[model samples]
Target: MEYITLNNGVKMPIVGTGTNTYGKVNNDYNGALTNEIPELESALELGYRSIDAAIMYRNEHLVGRVLAESTVPREELFITTKVPASEEYVSSKDATRAAIDNSLKNFQTDYLDLFLIHFPIENKEHLKNTWEVFEEYYEAGKLKAIGVSNFEKHHLDELKEFAKVKPAVNQIQINLKQPNKELLAICKEEGITPVAWGPMKAEDHQKEVLNEIGKAYNKTGAQVLLRYQIERGVVVIPKSHNPDNQRANLDLFDFELTTADVEKIENL
Candidate 1:
């Protein structure tokens, strides 16, 4: 797997496995345990070192179970989880503290490789206070790095003004349809690593374009899309239940895209 160095000098895998699911099916952590455990183990067996999870995803316990049983050493794995997106948690320092502690308990680990604000709250004071809490945890060794997800330029601007430590990452949706060029530029300017969540959108036209591009490299549409993001210095967490697809996501290092091909995809 390839790696990107965050502003804090920590190495993050460029590709990770995402664990978001629709509906409340994940509420039964025990029932859903069967659903993700094998797949996560399969991902690890296929050489995935990073696991992207969140409390809102409602499967941290399941993800934790995989980690608890994995043969891979803890030091070799990079685990990330997010705070709850609700206003109650996003606006309260005590609530945020309880949330992170719960995540730690759920993950069965003392320190998270990375933790991020799931989303930006409208209240600047609340957001800044929450970030300050993250900084405290970071200093206390409960979190290695702190960041935000789904933050726009205005949101980042506000955070930067009062932030003692700038966010290390900004997780957002990026795909062929929405390249998010402007947001990426802002992240680049602020020394934040851009992480693409939906790297492959599966749109018919987009897939066709990606396939056409992949034809030149003897790869698939998904592979081409992931390669495009990696070429642009964006970390991607492309999720797939299929082992073949999971393997393909990580098979981007063997080929390189020329400037022309990169621009072609960017223009799409």
Candidate 2:
């Protein structure tokens, strides 16, 4: 798989599987937990090393169990999980610390490749305390990298006010529908990598455009969309339960989009 080096020099797989609904009944975000995640096993077998999970999904332990039981060594996996900005998890520094320790236990690993604040903590104190806990873990070698998700420019500016370590990534919605051009540019300016959460999302017309673009490369529209992001230094975590789609998501290194094609996409 291709990798993107963060500002802190940590290499993250450009293409990873998102586990928001994995191991849940009916694959629903609020569904009951199941005993196992066959899709995760398939992803691992198909060479997917990065796994994006979040505590809000309520299946960390299950996702972690699959990773722990997999044959892939801990070092080869680029595991990323998020901490929610809630009273239960981030009411205080000690609370945040407990949440992180629980996550490590759930993952069955001492270190995580990346950890992110799942959302923008509105309260300055909560945000500061949460970030400090994250920095503490990062300094302690427990978290390889720390970042934020769904952060706007103002939130980023707020983080910059006192952040000892700049955020390594800003995970946001980046697709044809929500191009998020300004945020992307800011990330580039700040040397923070952009990770696309819903990379495959596209309106019907946008999909048509992507389809037409894909025809030239003998790839699917989904492939073209993901390629567009990664070609411009955006990491994409496109989730799919189908084994074929999972394989297709990672089948991105073989082709390159021409400058004209990229321009056309940018225009779209």
Q: What is the lDDT of candidate 1?
A: 0.86
In order of listing, the candidates' clash counts read 0, 0
Query: Candidate 2: which stretches are off by over 4 Å?
Result: none
Model 2 per-residue lDDT tens digits across residues 1-268: 8888999999999999999989889998888989789999999999999999998988899899999999999999999999998888889999999989999999999999999999999999999999999999999999999999999999999999999999999999999889999989999999999999999898899889999999989999899989989999999999999999999999988999999999988888
Worst 10 residues of 2 by lDDT: 27-36
| Model 1, span 157-242: residue lDDT tens | 88888889889999999887777889999899888999998888767987888899899899998898888889889999988777
Model 1 ranges with Cα > 4 A deviation: 22-36
In model 2, what lDDT does residue 70 have?
93
lDDT of 2 at 107: 99
Model 1 pairs whose backbones collide: none
Which prediction has the highest TM-score against the true structure?
Answer: 2
**TM-score for each model:** 0.93, 0.98
